[model samples]
Target: MIGTAKYLFGLSVGLIALLCFAAGAVIDRRPDVPRAPPPDAQEVRAALGFGQMALILMGTSSPVSFTLPQAWLDGVHSLVSHGKDNLAMDGRIDGRGAVFRVSKRLTRHGWLNLAFRLEETSAGGAPRLILYAGGWRAPEWLTAALLRMGLPLLGGSQELESLIPAFRAEDQTVQMTARVPRALVGGLQAVLGSGEGGGVDLELVRAIYGELLAGAVLEPEPDYARIVRRAAMQVDSAEGLKAALVALTMFTDGPRVLRLAGDRTKTPPCALTAFATRLHGRADTPKHWVLSAALTMFMDEKTGRAIGLWKELDDSLPGGSGFSFVDLAADMAGVRIGKAARDGTDIDKVIAGLRSGRPEIILPSAVLQLPEALPHHQWKRRYGPLEERRMMRQERLIGNLLDRSPLYSRLPPSRP
Candidate 1:
């Protein structure tokens, strides 16, 4: 009886080791996806335009269907994955369903890959999403089991339903139809329905850049207000102004704008010093956060995300610079600028004020009074979450200051 028990124990140990070895083999580290080349001027221009147009379309109430071509998706992917190779995605639509494969590098020696298919099904007389998941690093049964246990907790299905109300899968295409604001539907159709064929008009972009540079001599260190004024003066139509705004916000980093113009080597170091300086200044707010806040003006629903991302990033930093209300003030300034541009009214009046070259016209003086930086622990102790009363009061103070300013006051009322 003792010998039999020992034999059973040894067999169990061997089986466990074998299982671990098999699992390791399945999850072994492999070479990451090759780094994609950085998007060139044209690709960047197209992607930025598409994003802006998409946001505008999403605001409308008209239902429209559009197909995204593979090339366009690739450009967007390249732009989003510019400096990283740890994550990659490939998606396709077939008669059966829409399928996507996502790969994420989890560690130095392991990668997790997921393949999922979404099919539209009629259940209880309502269209529902049916998800089918497969695995690359694990067995199919294990992957399905994990997804069954995980997706409910993650609320993945509900989110998808909310984002995509209706979609039809065909060969090499998934056509999505959603209700957008009616007024913008025609314009959206003209721009988005063109697919990859609609490349950005570089000539117009160059003209906008030329206008910006023309005023540089008078105000060598033009602030945000000056730059907007120059662009607004050059673009007479709403569409043209939108294009100009998209170009301005495309790169939060000023040097990238110089590179976009052409070879950075040929451009003098001080050529766009003021423009670049303004972007990186203001209490060390991350450039990406500034970009997010600027972009959120078009999609008002995402304003909270921009604010949250900024606070989250500030919290992650070590040392004295935790969450800075000064940085928040700068972000609010950008958001105000974006909202003014989006309103497409009082362009003449706005230009007149900006032409005065008063920085205070756009950024009120009260922003200077906000605390520069507060460590995370201290910020929590005082303000708690961002929506807490103290924080809201501080934001209200900034709003009142902006309301009292000339530039922001001219525009219609908008969300902070």
Candidate 2:
């Protein structure tokens, strides 16, 4: 009996070890880079199709891969972030990293089809792009912040609920109203409940949007889609921005192409800074792994996708970084932060170690001007003081370009 029991125990131990070896081998396999839909896969016959797709190169991760158009964009950028803010595409945020694909046979008579994908796979490798453009406004807090910082904003106040009375007509539920921009007078007249007091702000903001930003005042009230089409005609039409955000935006339903390249001489108005999005929440606080892991974003939803890469840290883990931020970037860089394989024992050390390399820090393209732009609320939301110092120091590298670009000439730019 003793001999038989020993044999069974030895057999069970061997089986367990074999299972573990198989699991380790599976994890060790490299991730497969996604390829475009096959040539015969109906996109070619259909009117809607992507012009190009290709695996670009590896970024901050060892196992993680980057992809873009086979051709390089004249304007390309790379940078890092500690995970804050929404990606500002035309006006649509590619929220939750869900796919923002578009198809527009634009028939205005019926109802607007709002397609929201709950599945994250749909928005793979794409930042959120605008679907319909021309309606989004800088929120009042942001406006006040920017205005206080010295932007040429027309006007706004902190009691934003009062400032934008568009939905207060009958004390209804969260009503979704779509304003047609071209028909300015008609749009204003259509204002439901807040009376004349609200009309002026709407008209003023719309007019400025169309004129100073959009560069063309609409003759008649046009639907949001139409407004986007009209604005797309200009080199810098404020309305043109919408097409940049959503994957399938329409200029009267045309497929606008975005090329990605590394050359720094030129830039796309819509291109974004590539920042590292860490999802362990604030490492400074303990007992935060679950709350941080389940984070839901309120504004600028694209941060959701950046976090999607790290959603596997189940709520029950005895949480903490097994590796420092820097070390994790090196060790897990290429590994998919899948459900079974996230949450480290030393995340704090990993972060510190990676940064400790002391990479020559740079600024996000949006607020590269530093302390001078620092005072502006628009600038502050995107960049803080520590980054501001980095930006200030780095400007010397692009001093000549800053001197020549019309964009910078408008700002103080000089060191404070």
lDDT of 2 by residue, 113-182 (tens): 2222211223232221212212222233433443232222213222222221222111111111121222
Which portions of model 2 show Cα errors greater than 4 Å? 1-81, 85-237, 244-392, 396-400, 411-416
- Residue-level lDDT of model 1, residues 195-303, one tens digit each, is 1212334456556765665556556642555565566666654445444554454322453332222222444333353245252334243343235333543443134
Q: CA lDDT of each candidate? A: 0.49, 0.23
Clash numbers, per candidate? 6, 41
Worst 10 residues of 1 by lDDT: 191-200
Show the colliding residue pairs in model 1: 60-180, 60-181, 61-180, 61-181, 61-182, 62-180
